[model samples]
Target: MMKILLIVFNWVGKGTYWRALKFAEHLCRRGREVTLLATSQHNRIGIEERIINQVRLVETPDLFTGSLRSGWDMWNVCNRIAWLRNHDFDIVHVFEARPVALFPALYMQRIKHISLVMDWADWFGKGGSVEERPNPIIRNILRPVETFFEEHFRTWADGTTVICTTLQQKATELGVPPNTIVMLPNGCDTERFEVIPHQIARRRLHFPHDMLIIGYMGSIFQHDAELMACAFDIICQQIADVRLLVIGYCPIDIRQLVKKPQYVIQTGFIEDEYLNNHLASCDVCWLPFKNTNANKGRWPLKLNDYMAVGRPTIATAVGDVVSLFETEPIGLLAEDNPMSFAEKSMQLLHDSTLRLEMGTHARHVAETRFSWADLTRRLEDLYQYILKTGTK
Candidate 1:
């Protein structure tokens, strides 16, 4: 069995962390010995305990607050390198391409090391030269540091894996060899999101059975609030039975839009169980992304989650979403305008046969292409290739 060491900054409540966990779990189940090194700042001890095989947690002290900033983040790379010099491992996989981690990964490669680089930052426009909205002095001060980490990490990694083709192109533009980059898209835990009876789920949530519910799940990022509010306002005006179910945290200004009881149902920052329950009850899942530079490379995780539960998705044609869904016979891709979103959503709501058919097709696509099991297999193949050839 090959021994693998996986290095990441921290494991908090994020999509990247979940993907890393699933990847580790899958590799371990395949009889590969794996060790995960993560920061202890986020109280991830519980997360460590859930894994099936050998694992270790290195608790580094938080330097700034002695509570949040893991001072050892920079030292973590050197320490891991020093430890690895004495230890033996077949491969080192770095999830986030930060300088602190890259220095160690590069060092490992210099000794003829084998590894896989999972790049998420490049896709989100973090390394690009695109102009961002002007921010306060603090943000400006920290911007350079963020850029340095992103740029260095991309240049140093041996074999790079990106979430979307847009990101892979960005990596090539940034000097990474075209052949070194591979697409390892985000995937959903389909079995966890198996279709449940819609009316039963609605009744469990105490949602009105008569109302036509449209839902949005996951974190509300930049400009999401304004776009969702504008779309919902237009949707409510046209369809009397239409109700919006928002399952995550919303900004204060956006939450105020739900004041009118007839239009909105805001379940502020729901737990995973409740969020899944509400999703199972939804008539349509909304993914309203703003047409910003950062959004251009996005492959929303919610898209797969929505599809897994057999819910019809209505989203903006931002990033690679059009390519992913337009080919599928399941969902609708609307323009980024409120009127367009409202019109498309209403059309889906009015046609029950179409909704059911689309939902079934969406679930089929997710099961065949987007399941975590299938995704892990792709990662495993990448890992095996790195081990055999030491480079892509």
Candidate 2:
């Protein structure tokens, strides 16, 4: 039987943590013994363990819950590494390259003689997401540290998984073996969400049946949020019955930026059970991203949320999203401007038949291409390659 250890730098909240859990759960059902190591959400000083859907979840305490990155707890890594020495795993998959994430993963590779695969799901250094930081001084300080962690450790991996072609190109440019680098976007958890009728969902959520709902899911970075706010303002100028459904946690109150605060409905972070209900309430979903390195380097988890509920998206033409639009008529892509975005949105709003068609296509692609079952095959294939050939 294959044994796999999955290590995440943070608690079970962010996109990366969810990705690790989903992959671990999928692997466990396939008869692979999988263990997931993550930081506990609370600042407790104790470690905890449990079995969730047949996968062992080990959460180590992290103190810095207030920091932007969070989970700078090297204590857990040290203690876990010391304890992990007694266990044997065929593969160790590390998500991201932070102090807490990298240290234990490197220990598994170097000290325990286990095969290591590093996953790069975001571009966080220098010209990427660092540009999104509000403070210039903080950005300048983090440039070197972020680069060192994000770029310096790729060669240590036996294999690598990237979320987009842009990051895959960056990894290969950094001299990671091209064959070892697989472009694996975050898979849609189709099993978790069922397609609900848009009107029925709106009624369930107590939203007005007359309003044309445009939903945006999850927290967004600052740059994208500004662009989204601008686009929404423009959208209101043309449509009267429109409303913005801001589902989950957003850094800023979207109502503050828009022309009409009354039209914006902000449902702060709700549970997983109500996720589909919230998402399905939208007539159209928003994916307003500017054409930048930051947007290109990462796949938005909200895109998966939009797909799960079978809602057509009004996205700006950028990076891998453009590749997605080309492959399937899942949604319409607009230029990175308010006028263009508002225009494409108007086009979708007016045509109900086209919107429904695109929504069905979005749902189909999510089920077939981006489902966890299908994506797990690619991951397992990479594992098979490493196991058969011996780790690099």
Candidate 3:
């Protein structure tokens, strides 16, 4: 049996947590022994550990009690490394690059002859809260150290997987061989996100029967939520009974812009348990992103959920959206502006037949291209190849 260890940097129930959990679960279903290593609060650590579908999760506890940011992060890294020393794994797959924790794992890999694979999902040192506002002196001091470890690991790893072509390009630019990089986009559970009766879902959510609902998922900061609100407001003027449904946390600034609070409904932070049902209630999904370098590298996870539920998406022509949806008629691709977005959304809203056709195309794409089964098969291939070659 192949034993694989997946290391996630944080223990949040969203983003990396969901990705790690889904991958671990699917990999386990393929008859591989998978253990997910994550970090949580001292009281919560190890308490949630359980074998679910043959995947074991072991969360290390933070050493400190309070939320002293730097101290908590440093201690968490040390704790994870200490826990890793006692375990045995044939393969170690790390989701993000953090030198403090990863360096210790690398040392173990060298001594233990364990294979290492690194995954790149987004841009480093850009747009996160810590990176957004940092002490310049510290940032400058750590820049070289961060770069040294990142490049060293990328060059040393047996194999690498990236979320998009843009990141693959970045890896090549940084001296990683093109052959070593596999482009793996985000995917969804097609079985879980299947089409539900529109009225049935709406009735459950208490949505109006005759309303045209446009929805957006994920955290508010990921995309231009204010622009989405602006686009929805414009759509409302052209079509009566148009409603905006936000399934995740909405920022206070974005919340302040909505003119008709009654027409716009925000279900802040929908848990994974109720995500599918809430997503199925939408008539259309929006992916409104401001054109930025970081945004270009992102292949939004919500795209999969939208496609999985057979809903048409009106998205900006950025990142993988152009390659994924522009050529095919699965979704409408518009320029990154409010007017263009509103126009394309209104197009979908005006024609029920077009929306239905697009939705069907979206689901077909999901089944063929973005299903978790397909993704796991591809990863299995990569794993076999890496084990055979010893390095790629």
Candidate 4:
């Protein structure tokens, strides 16, 4: 069995954690030995221990403090390089676009390395411009330094993988060979989200039997909360049985909007099992992302989770979301407007046939196409290719 070493900034509660976990699990199941090397904390101990036989935790000092000085970041880079030089592995997999972590791994190229660019961070400065990114104070101070480090790392890696086509194009523009870069879209773990009886789930959550629950589960930003509140108000006016179930953190100011009796149910920061319970109960799941630079390149992880249980979703047409759901006959896509969002959501709530059909299709897609097993196969193939070619 071939040995693999996966490296990332830190592994906690995020998209990266899920991606790494899925990949490691798939590799281990195939009789390959996998070792995950992360900066600190191992919060998903249960998942990792189940899959990977070895996990190495490296200690690195916090670089982002008050001021944007270069010293701290530079110190962290040196420390990471020291750690990498001491470790021996057959293949190294690095995630993140930051040069601080990339540079050290690139310098220690005794073993083959694969760099997976999850998102293009440099695009944040340009206001989505391709020719030149905006010269913000932070970018102006950091871009040149990061570029120098990235250039070396890009050239050093044995192979590279990008999450989306747009990201692959960006990497090509940045001088990475088109052949070296591979496309591996984010995916969901379908087994974890098996469908439960809606009525049973509602009973478990203590939600009313007859009400239509429009649920959302994630960090509710202020703008998102306001938009959802506005949409809910419109839906309530049109349909009396409609109720909102928000299962994540919402700011104090926004929480006030849901205070109207029998209108909204707020379960802030629920555990995963409870969140899944809420997901099973909901009539529909929401992916209300604002059309901003922050969201354009985003591939919301929740969409897969929502679909895993055969739940139809309503989302704003932002980033690669349009493409992700365009083929999804199971969900509805709307413009990033409250009126449009409300109209689309109501369409799903009012028609049980449409909901059932879409939900069935969604579950089929989740099981066949978006399963973690399939996603990890793609990742494993890329790892083997990198090992064979000795380039990323």
Among these predictions, the greatest lDDT belongs to 2
Q: What is the TM-score of each candidate against the true structure?
A: 0.85, 0.97, 0.89, 0.80
lDDT of each: 0.69, 0.87, 0.75, 0.66
Instruction: Show the lowest summed lDDT stretch of 10 residues, model 4.
Output: 42-51
How well does model 3 score by local distance difference test? 0.75
What is the TM-score ranking, best to worst? 2, 3, 1, 4
Clashing pairs in 2: none
lDDT tens digits by residue: candidate 3, 1-392 = 98888877655354666677778889988999999876654543332466766889876665444332112265566666666777888788887676534654575578777888888776654332223223677666655655555456787788788988877887898788787778888886686687886788999878888998988886645347777877877887888888888887654445567677677788886767787778888889999987765677657888889999989999988888898785668779888888999999999888889988998998888888777777877887777888888876
Q: How much does candidate 4 score in TM-score?
A: 0.80
lDDT by residue (tens digit), candidate 1, 228-280? 88888887777777888877766434557543555777777777767677898
Q: How many residue-pair clashes does candidate 3 contain?
A: 0
Candidate 2 matches the true fold with a TM-score of 0.97
Higher-TM-score candidate of 2 and 4: 2
Candidate 1 residue 295 Cα shift, in angstroms, is: 1.4
RMSD of 2: 1.3
Clashing pairs in 1: none
The regions of model 3 sitting more than 4 angstroms off are: 41-48, 63-72, 99-101, 126-152, 251-253
